[model samples]
Target: MSCTETGAALHVEGLCWGPRPGLTLVDDIGFSIEAGSRLAILGPNGAGRTSLLRCLYRAVQPNAGRIAIDGVDLWSVSAREAAKTIAVVLQEMPGDFPFSVRDVVMMGRIPRREGLSGWSELDRERVAHALSHLDLAHLAGRQFATLSGGEKQRVLIARALAQEPRIIILDEPTNHLDIRHQLEILDLLRTLKLTIVSTLHDINLAAEFATDVAIITEGRLTAFGSPDAVLSPRELSAAFGVTATVHGAAASGGTRFSFSLPRQGSLS
Candidate 1:
């Protein structure tokens, strides 16, 4: 795998979204991430982390705001054009598809297909590369539904990689994997040159994998910066209503964290 693709910069300003009037799932939010940066979104459940991601990937339209990719308005482009630039790996795995892993990965090339032509040589090459990149070459012949949970996740990621997008957005990419697979997946993601935006539940993992972090709560962005700067005990405690403690420096690659309920009468 080669890390040669230069990722695009992402910018969001005054973003808001909701299903109905007076109900906002993603409040006014603003942030910017440089090219090739990995951004981890963290917050308590229903804090709108996923909602914010949906807005960024154009899964759902924001009520108002601007989303720019490399200074180009994201909304100004067509869905097909956006698909060519942005790939998404959702948390929910698809239902048992009666297709082989290779077939599934080939679907990623749909956005790049020209007119009604068949799959081109470039599509096959990309699929093969994605399979090898994710270490799924041997499993390419296997039925996708028969694979284990971790394998399924890898296949989904490989599909995303086949899309050859400048930016990849994931909703809990490590959801079904065990500790080892989680670490492996995150390590692989760190090596990719693409811009990564993911919603992660593990604060420590986020600290380890993200080049930058954005903490969202109550549908608003409360903190955004390097893990060392934003993952402070104060911010964690305030955002999660827990006692947070940082145990190691990020530079050491051993930045551990511990969290516990606040003491009695602490909530006011």
Candidate 2:
């Protein structure tokens, strides 16, 4: 429950990844995330959002460019050191994991330097707080496989929270949830004072939750700025090839958007 009060800053420069030059999935991407800021990456399918994320978390090495975490080059750090600093919640989970929800959450503590002391009282307290924070206390004893998709997603997020990471990277954290749970999860993220970088399918959710937004398409970053500045009708039409109407978020004061397909034979 107790994380570093200040999150680490992230910087990326000319980040590219693929088996070879011509086949790059993420090309010439560059961005910076100030400490404790939330950034949402939006793009159409196969635009390489996930590929870019994989580079940040070091799932795959970038063929070119640099990734720096709080002024430290991420690739220069040991994998264990990086794990302690960054926690990620991906879209998929191991369906047949033979572990209880609490057990799975406890795994997050493995990255910390406990020095052979084994699971400590502090660890248990953190796990408990994460469970309650995610509204999973009653399901603590339930098997992970028995939970619904929404519940499973929440469990993954709880696990990430228990890690007490400086930065949390999520890939479509709202993928499986109903509207209520989606809002609930995003709300919980909003309360955390950590750096959050996520790939979101819903432009509305990004506008509501993110302080900054990056719009990428065809493996390139097209727009990056405040959600209000980046999520415009022009960017929407260019990135998605659809006609959209942009509006204010009403009482929430965030940006809102709606879209419609192009007219017949209008597709370029």
Candidate 3:
């Protein structure tokens, strides 16, 4: 509920990923996130945002490049150790398991254990804290499959918190939530004392929540910097193939934007 100590920094260099031999989905994209800073990855469909994120969390193998946390190579560590440092809340829902909400959240503690005997006192305390923080205490006993989309998203976030990670990676964490829930979730993420890297669909939400923004188009990074610097109309137009207008800055609040189709039918 209160602000915690700052988290680790993230560095990505020359990252590339692809399924086939010659076709790259994420092409030499690179960026860095300072400790406790929040970064929003923005791009149109097929822009490799998800692919780039997947490499960070080890969802897929990258053909080239490096990911480091606090100057340590991420892939060099064991998977369990990596889980301790980074937790992820992805877009897809878990399969319908007959687990209770508490059971689902307790899974996050698995990587913290040294042996598979039983839950430690620290694990219980973390689960309780995460549930209370995310407002899932009342629903702790409910079946996981019965919750609404917003509730489900919160539950997943609670699970991620239970991991006690230094960095949190989310892929479209606000997907399927109503406007109110979207704002609430983003607000919560922004306050956490952990490094945040998320892919966001709503440009306005990115403007509101991100300390830094990365714009990718056609598998390449076009921009990376403070939201105000990277989200200019020219960058937006180039990345999205649309004419864009900017109203204000996200850092000082009241930032607004509008978009329209380009009259020229081609980008020059």
Scored by TM-score, the top model is 1
Order of quality (TM-score): 1, 3, 2
Error of 1 at 255 (Å): 1.9
Report lDDT (Cα) of residue 10, candidate 1: 94
Candidate rank order under lDDT = 1, 2, 3
Query: Which runs in model 2 stand beyond 4 Å of their true positions?
Result: 1-3, 113-117, 248-254, 264-268
Candidate 3 ranges beyond 4 A from true positions: 1-5, 248-252, 265-267
List TM-scores for all candidates, in order: 0.96, 0.93, 0.94
For model 2, what is the C-alpha lDDT against the true structure?
0.89
- Compose the digit string of candidate 2's lDDT tens values, residues 1-268: 2248567899999998996767989999999989999999999999999999999888999999999988899999888888988999998878998999999999999987478887999899999999998899999999999998878888998999899898999999998779998998899888888899999999888988999899989899999989778888888888999988877664478457899998977656
Task: State residue 143's C-alpha deviation in candidate 2, in Å.
Answer: 1.2
- Tens-digit lDDT track for model 1 on 48-82? 99999999999998899999999888899999889
RMSD in order of candidates: 2.3, 2.3, 2.7
lDDT of 3 at 186: 94
Could you tell me which residue pairs clash in candidate 1? none
Top-lDDT structure, candidate number: 1
List per-prediction Cα lDDT, in the order shown. Answer: 0.92, 0.89, 0.89
